[model samples]
Target: MGCSRPGAVAIVSVFLAGALAMISLVLPYWSKMEIVTAAGEKIEVALGLWGACTSVHPPALDTLTAPVIANGSEVIAIEPESALSDSFTCGSFYDDERVRISCTSFRELANGQCKRREFRGPASLCDVATTASFLGDSTAVVPDATVSDWLSVVDNACHGIGHTAVALAVLSAISASLCGLLLFVGITCGAIESRLGRVGGYCAFATATLQLALAVLWTAEAHPIRYTEHAFATSFYLNAVSILLHAAAFVAAQRHQSLEKEALAAMDLDGGIHADGAATEDKEKAMGSSKATELVAV
Candidate 1:
């Protein structure tokens, strides 16, 4: 009877929202890598939410480890007139599907890739660290294959978010859980019925608002306009929908509470009017009996 509010529906909605939010937390939200070439060929690599497949040996779940490759080539000579630069290519190919690679080596950037000796050829890939930064913001190198149609068609996997985003996500998750608790107690707690309804409404509303705000903040920090290729992930969208549901639940609960109060007041008013009418009837009956007796005496 939370102010005669509808508690059952509110509880169900809250439960569903909480469950969805928790599920989103576990799912990989945004780990897809979009690649494009200057000639217009595009490819996408999925580095799972929790881990990535850097090389074929085994999928590394904790950290990104470079592949292992033996250094066998000698250094290329560079003259002031040659087109030589600091950049070097390990190997390039026609298509990524044409070749098989293994998580066989880790690269030493200063030591001529996987080798300590001088080496040269087409580049295996753009540096992972560099590419990681590129994913967040633009202005980073886009690795290319040597061939015109199918140049450096290199792709791999990576993971992890910035400290700020992680912090926000954790805070949001906590707030969401608390909101669910409030809803549950508000509906079932007998001692604080009327108060719990309003309290739960406010708590859920506030938490959802915070979630939306933090989502925006996370997006702003993680995928700013600086990057030409950034899109909101499944996690962001799911949270958005959950927030909407929370808002709806809050409104429903508040309205039910207001209506309940009005009904209770109306019932009290009606009862008082009925009591006064009964008393008036009793007094009229007494007066009529006395008048009849006087007439008989006269």
Candidate 2:
């Protein structure tokens, strides 16, 4: 057979990696965090490529516990004693495919005496729908052109990078699928042709490279602040695993190509020797026939 067990295993890895990537895309576990609000309410958040979900729990039992509020741009205080396993009401938010920007905006209301800071975090669709119309409307509170321009620049950059990362991830999945098809053909044929093997290896490498870029873009643009207790979840880890698998597939394809070349060289050398031996034997037979004819004629 042209393909060895290692090459077959490599092909399987590509398909497996593709499956993981698909799962990662569908899952909403790219980032997870459990936080406690200043009002003693515990909220658990999970973010994904397409959407996010939140679980809210009732306030802590200990009413005497002093609540600590963070006025700055930092993570809310989390109660160390709180357990994530606790039951709570879970709701989906920002289910739209577009990236969401969670921010806190401070605006001066018509009443000069009251300056209010509005925080927009991950919330259920219902909660978001019920928010005040002017809550997230940037036009409603643009203090000046400079601030508005800065906000626009930041928002556009975030959206661009986030969408690009998602597109790369989808492309990587397609690349992985193509690589898997090439690998299947190679294995079934009992040897991967040099050209086909090269193509397959390139595809695998492309998949890995795309995955790496996806991760970088996601972290740079979509990742929330770590101070908010946010950490990578299973979906991100699955993507990392898929990258490793693609790299392994690329290495296996190279090895298969080398083996194929060596096999072809060996076959060519043996065929050449057999051809030379047959020619020599034919020459000897012709010479013997001529000598016998001369003897008979004489």
Candidate 3:
């Protein structure tokens, strides 16, 4: 058969690894970054598998990443402390999927203070409902005039890199699953000695090991650049754990093969010893009979 008891255990381990890898892909297994705005307000946000959720909107079932706060389309205060006696509304426009700012303005007022304005131009992912209102100044749109951009820039520096990381995570999970399956098939086949079965097992083990190494290497590469403001979520770790389990199974299978070979060699040695002992006994008996005949002749 393909495997003895140890081989069976390896098969189980591979299956577990594959199952966990698939689960990791679906779970919200990335980091939640709590970005603090100028007003010392903590904005909780998570990105990757479950999508992007910002503390700006409450967690929702519909979007992968929704705003935490429910104040739809409100001003994201870049300069929350700056007094707005004459801070007129700046016009906004979409630059690709993201909105761009041309100037600044107030949207709402309470107690003679600006309470809401436009976070008006944020990324597509963060276009969640805000309480930001228009500055009602259509004349504020500037054409080719040279004007300094307002301080209303949202901190989405990690966003572009985060998307790249997402793709990597997905690919890693898929590769891991495939390798795990190969390992499983190799261990469960009763025809362990068959060329196909042996090839399957070896290929599975090699692929899994290589994938694990590559995943770690890629994570290291992304760490300094991407995760400076973020972190790895539970799902990422789970995926790594799956890869580790495959390694464990590979080790187990190797040990089992070693022991099997040792047993066969020992058995052959024992048979040879027994045969030699029988030959020696037959020779001794023949010699004794000849000596007796010679004695009788004397």
State how far residue 71 of model 2 sits from its true place (Å): 45
lDDT of 2 by residue, 67-102 (tens): 433558643433442321233222233332223322
**After superposing candidate 3, which stretches have Cα over 4 Å from the reference?**
26-28, 37-43, 49-182, 191-214, 217-229, 281-298
Best lDDT among the predictions, by candidate number? 2
List TM-scores for all candidates, in order.
0.54, 0.64, 0.50
lDDT of 1 by residue, 147-196 (tens): 21111111211112333444555776786777678767666664333666
Worst 10 residues of 2 by lDDT: 102-111
Clashes of each: 13, 2, 27
Root-mean-square deviation of candidate 2: 12.1
Ranking by TM-score, best first? Answer: 2, 1, 3
Mark the regions of model 2 whose C-alpha exceeds 4 Å error after superposition: 1-3, 60-158, 189-191, 194-198, 222-226, 286-298
Q: For model 2, which pairs clash?
A: 2-190, 2-191
lDDT winner between 1 and 2, please give it. Answer: 2
lDDT of 3 by residue, 1-298 (tens): 5667767766677678767767765654344444333333334433334233333311213222322332467643334223222332222122213222222223433334433344524433223222111211121331111011111111121345444444655665655566556546655654443343344345446646654654554354334423224566676677678777777667766655665577779989999999999999999999999999999999
Q: How accurate is candidate 1 locally (lDDT)?
A: 0.49
